[model samples]
Structure formats: C-alpha cells, structure tokens
Target: MGWIYLILAGCFEVVGVTGMNKVIKNKNVQAYMILFTGFIFSFGFLSLAMRTLPLGLSYAVWTGIGTVGGTIVGMLYYGDSKDWRRILFIAMIVIAVMGLKLTSS
Candidate 1:
C-alpha cells in the first residue's frame, strides 16, 4: 500500500541520515555506500507512494517520520541532546503525523 511505501521511505531516510553522520565522523567508505543506497531507496519509495497519496500530506508525513526518527537516532547513537523540550516537540510531530493520516480519506 501507499502508506507502507511512505513508512519505508521514512525509515530509509533515517538510515541515510545516520549513514551521513557515520561518513562524516569516520570517513568510512561503507558508510558512504549506506548513505547512497538508503537515500536511493528512500526516494524511490516516496515516489511510489506519491502515485496515489496527496503530495502535501505525503511529504509532511515523510518528513515528520524522518525528523522524529533522525532525532531519536541522534540521541541513541550520536549522544545528541535529550531534554523534555525535545521529547515534547517530537511528540507533537508524531501527533501531527497521526492527524494527517487519520484525516486523509
């Protein structure tokens, strides 16, 4: 389904972003490969979902997923900040994404 593709796209987006961080931190060629592959799959899945989903709604959901996922990844692996404010904002984004999905026909 379109939603499935969209979700997968978001997951891959996180992978790609994490890969980019890895590449920068360690200059690993394998990380670069992951970056390339993850992005390619991310966009590919996003495009597939766009065939049926509304553009604005789909994009917002995709970016919301990527933003939240990337933030969590940063906190978990890269030692990024993890405060109440950050958690609250991430929750808001998740709520917005859920709202979009629920409101869409």
Candidate 2:
C-alpha cells in the first residue's frame, strides 16, 4: 500500500512537472489549476506513502519515478531530445532505481 501510494505520488509529480511547463508557456487559469492540483495530490499521496516506507528509500524512489516519468513525457509530448546518450542515461537511472528497490526491505 505504501509502495503503491509512492508510485502514485511519483506519477502526480510528472503531472506537476507538465503543469509547470504549461504554466510557463501559457500562464492561464487552467495551467495554474493543473499545477496546484498536481502538486497537492502528489504531496498528499507522498505523505500517505511515508506511513510504511522508509524516508530515504521512499524519497529516492519517488524522485526516481518523477525523473524518469518527466523525461519520457518531455520526449514524447514536448519535443525533448531523444538522443541515444540521453536514453542511455535514463536507462541507467532506471537500473539504479531498481537496485535501490531490491536493496530495500
């Protein structure tokens, strides 16, 4: 349950990131709503996740998910570079995240 909430928090973090970009580009009421709503839910779920997950482990995983998810979203929707090197680094982050999860109890 904690892990699940953590994952959800990470997912919302991506939404927040997206909203940030939208706000920067457009700066409308809808953009503000997305940004605030996304971050609010993200923090809410993160706090819920902390009930069972260790602080360090949960934080690392949450940020990892956000990093990876945000990068993918940028590449797919926002025209970020899809360079091989960038992808390789992203893959490395994924591997390190997996390693952390494996090490955690």
Candidate 3:
C-alpha cells in the first residue's frame, strides 16, 4: 500500500510538471488550475507513502522518480533536450534511488 502511494506520487509529480509546462506555454487559467491540483495530489500521496517508508528512502525515491519522470515528459511532450548524456545521468539517479530503497529496508 505504501509502495502504491509512492508510485502514485511519482506519477502525480510527472503530471504536475507537465501541466506546469502547459501553463507556461499558453498562460491559461485552466492550465494553472490543473497544475495546482496535480501538485496537491502529488504531495498528498507522498505524505501517505511516508507512513511506512523511511524518511530518507521515501524522499530519495520520490524526488528521483519525479526528476526522471518529469525529464522524460518534458523531452517527449515539450521538446526539451533528450541527449544521451542527460539520459545517462537520469539512469544513474534511478539506480541510486533503487539502491537507497534496497539498503534502507
């Protein structure tokens, strides 16, 4: 259940970041609303996840997942950079996040 919450939080983080880009592009009220809503839901799920997971492990995973997810979304949807070097760095972050979970448990 906690894992589920963490995953949901990560997904929401991605959604919030994507919505933010949309809001920036069009500068519409609806986009801002969606972005704000996504942020609220993301934090809600993240808080739920903290109940079971260690603080450092949960935070590392949450932030790492969010970073990677947001970068991918930006690259695909917003025409952001997709260079190999950047992708490699993101992969490292994912590995580190996994290591934190494995060792913290």
Candidate 4:
C-alpha cells in the first residue's frame, strides 16, 4: 500500500498546487482551507509511503507525479502554454515515473 499512499500524496500535492493558484487569483478562507488541507494530507501520506519505499525512489516518483499533474492542471484549467515542447517534456516525465516503478522492487 506504500505505492498507493505515494500516489495519493502526489495527487494531493496537485490539489495543493491548485489551491495555490486559486489563492493567488483570489484570497479567501475556502482557498486557504484547500491549501492547508491538501498539504497536510500530502505530507501525511508521503510519510506513510516512506515506511516501505526507498527514500530516493519515493521522492523521485512523488515529485514526478506532482510535476506532471500540476503542469497538466495548469494547461487544462489555467490556460498555460500547450506547446509541443511542453507536452513532450510532460510525456518524458511520465515515462521516467513508469520506469522508476518498473525498476523498483
């Protein structure tokens, strides 16, 4: 279940990133709640994942997921750049995350 927790942590990290974007655009209690709650859950799950996963492997995968997730969120909801180069880099990150998962025991 360590992998599950790690994936959840990564997802929550994206939620936190979204909250950050919201807070930047509009400061309010709801946004603040989302921001703090997302990070709290993210860190909690990450710690749980560390119990079974190697530190380096876990951190790399977590950040990879977050980076990909956040970038996609930006592209989808925030109207960030959708250039081919940006998509190519996102795909690379996904491939790297998959490779790490495959290599890990």
lDDT of each: 0.96, 0.94, 0.87, 0.95
Write the residue-wise lDDT of candidate 3 on 1-105 in tens digits.
888899899889888887898898898998998799888999999999999987877788888889999998888877889899999999999899778767875
Best by lDDT: 1
lDDT of 1 at 64: 97
Better of 2 and 4 by TM-score: 4
- TM-score for all predictions? 0.98, 0.96, 0.92, 0.98
Question: Which regions in candidate 3 have their CA more than 4 angstroms from the true location?
Answer: none
- Candidate 2 displacement at residue 93 in angstroms: 1.0
Which window of ten consecutive residues has the lowest lDDT sum in model 4? 32-41
TM-score of 1: 0.98
Q: What is the TM-score of candidate 2?
A: 0.96
Q: Give the distance in Å from residue 9's predicted Cα in candidate 4 to where it truly belongs.
A: 0.3
Off by over 4 Å in 1: none
Give the per-residue lDDT of model 1 (tens digit) for 1-105.
Answer: 999999999999999998999899888889999899989999999999999999999899999999999999999988999999999999999999999999999
C-alpha RMSD values across all candidates:
0.6, 0.7, 1.2, 0.6
User: What's the CA error at residue 19 for candidate 1, in Å?
Assistant: 0.8
- After best superposition, candidate 4 residue 87: deviation in angstroms? 0.5
C-alpha RMSD between model 3 and the true structure: 1.2
**Residue 95, candidate 1: alpha-carbon lDDT:** 100
Candidate 4 structure quality by residue, lDDT tens digits, 10-70? 9999999899988998899999889998889999999999999999999999899899999
Q: Compared with the true structure, what per-residue lDDT tens digits does model 2 show for residues 23-104?
A: 9999999999999998999999999999998999889989999999999999999999999999999999899989988998
Q: Can you list the residue pairs that collide in candidate 2?
A: none
